[model samples]
Target: MPRTQVTGRTGPRRALTVLLPLLLATGTPLSVGVPASAAEPGAVRLPVMPSRLAAGASCTSASHEVATATPWEQRSLELPKVWPSGSGAGVKVAVVDTGVSQQARALAGRVTAVGGATADQDCVGHGSFVAGLIAAAPVKGVHFAGVAQQAAILAVRGTDDRGVATDTTVAGGIRAAVDAGARIIEVSPALADRSRTLTAAVSYAAGHDALIVAAAVPDATTTTMSTDTPPRSYWPADEAGVLSVVAVDAEGQAPQGSPAPRHADLAAPGAGVIGIGPGGTGHFIGSGASLAAGYVAGMAALVRAADPELTAAETANRLTTTAYPADVPRLDPYAALTSVPDTATHGEKPAEEAVRLPEQHTDAGTTRRALLVAGGGGALLLLVVWASAVVPRGRARGWRAAARNRPTGTS
Candidate 1:
């Protein structure tokens, strides 16, 4: 069955307005794709800023050294708390982006190159960086720990030379991952076009109960040039059956005045994030909905680990329910792991017959005094009436006796 398509209110023109500021400041379009082979025809490749690690040609032996971490490492916010150790160990997370490097020491056992018929290998470093965010196993010597340290990743390359991810290539990569039995699918790419073939593939993944996470597209046009609204549209992410995510900072806050309705469902650490840069082990810090999407993907792995039987809808519900409400609230890990349905009903009750509860009685002494006062007043009134009646009758009798005595005396 075809899946439902969620149409976002933020169209292309508005996106351009919001994105114009960054574009003008950078003085060029942000190239975002890394293709496997020669550039595809008519594909626009945006120049992705290189990673800090990219300066070094080969992996260093010292990159494998173990190191102490920060408090974030101990908190569930940094790692998957719901999934037990080794639970998601075998589960593969298929990341459709630039391919992962086979020689990266951190990805030694965890990375699986899923290059097939659809897309090229990781020519640019964007896909590998996302892969690291999702499942980079905790290296003793590494600076950061991934969200799902044990979850395996299948890297599917989809970008072209202009740093653009095409609709056809992206759809092909998604289908490939589903066919490969990926338990979870993470997509950071949002193209300009929305096709039936692409939507159907995403729907198929959801129908098969696979959790999909995607980044909300940002604005693209320069805002300084015009008073008119700029383009602010994002495809695929705005599509149905995909959990859309918005960017948040380390303090757990999203951007201000972010386009409502089309904003991400959850927020995660986005600002000042440290990850591998293009083609090298360089550390790159970035802020965007893409990072937020990665956090949701990690959380989804945790959810699946906790309840493997959960459907895509149910899993989404858990994530949405647990998500801490932010400016553009993204997914919440603690809430998703522990949220329940709210059964509360609202509105006032209808008027009905009033029912009274038992009232408190006075003490025995106080009651006795009240009764005595009432009894004594009644007794005194009765006594006074009786005395008055007797007195009257006695007076009449005395008068009658006096009259009789006087008569006798005369005789």
Candidate 2:
């Protein structure tokens, strides 16, 4: 049987006017796939993992292929620069999706199920994949790692065993995550229908100071309804207090067939992204706005860990406002962690005072280069000033000397 595609709205809507040029200017390569020959001998090539299984399909198997090349998303996000401030330690991020597997190696000893054992079991592997994106630890040889490596994952079931989700399940997941004291809640599935239950659940989470991050659009699959469907809002994401995230490719373009949301707070790398699956030392490839939401949730954990004093709303504001500005602002983990919030431009009321974070550890080479540039600029300015002052005086003195030499005889 063909795998069931997780789908809702379809068709791309908006172009990333400035994001593509910014990415290209940085010269970060845009490919996520590592060729089979690039892998160690005897390592199998990674396969595309399914978001959901067809009615009676077998469970997702362990992948033996390990991605050795650094994923483009990792390079683009520049997570290493942000880690010096915090690695998301002490932050509990709730993954409300198909469920996270405890068997995933990278996430070992960090996952806690919310309701029951079912929430810890991942038959479809989608939740585990999402979880890995958020908090997977660094492995010896693999180049892939999660955003907040020290963060903990709270696994909650927003979808059934086969990875099908409904309004009720997702709403319940939010409430459960909030009640469990998860600071950051990531909702993976994007439903087409808007439910009062989901809205209230989001409000409940907000009231409890839980940051809810959700997918702005659904995952694209072969089973998606149609490519011509008009863009519309997705639930939970469209709700207030929820951070709606859209997925962009390496080139900052939305993946084909993945409809753009009417409104998205941030954009993240989601297309052709690589991550670990349930019970795998190897990796799997997945895509969509849902994956993008996972990235945002991880970054939120980092922010919360670094500055526990910031309210959930404040944390969200920091992430969005500090992002690389574009149609939908691109997620900049380093900026979110390091940049001071400017309440004026955000139009939000100022806090008691601007909370300044400690100085971040930057690359020595980069710092040295910056200092050199500053020194050079200062020297150039001094030269310009000296020339401006001396040239005029010298010209005036030469004119006076010529007049003196003329001895009152010249016209």
What is the TM-score of each predicted model, taking all chains together?
Answer: 0.60, 0.74
- Model 2 C-alpha lDDT per residue in residues 268-381, reported as the tens digit of each score: 988768899899698877777889899999999999998887889999999998998777888999989988655464456765856543447356776788789999999999
Leading candidate by TM-score: 2
Score each candidate by Cα lDDT. 0.56, 0.80
- lDDT of model 1, residue 397: 88
Each candidate's number of clashing pairs is 44, 0
Give one digit per residue, the lDDT tens place, for model 1 in 291-396: 5576677777766766676666677777877765545554556666656433231133655757643345466777788789999999999999999988788787
Q: What TM value does model 1 have?
A: 0.60
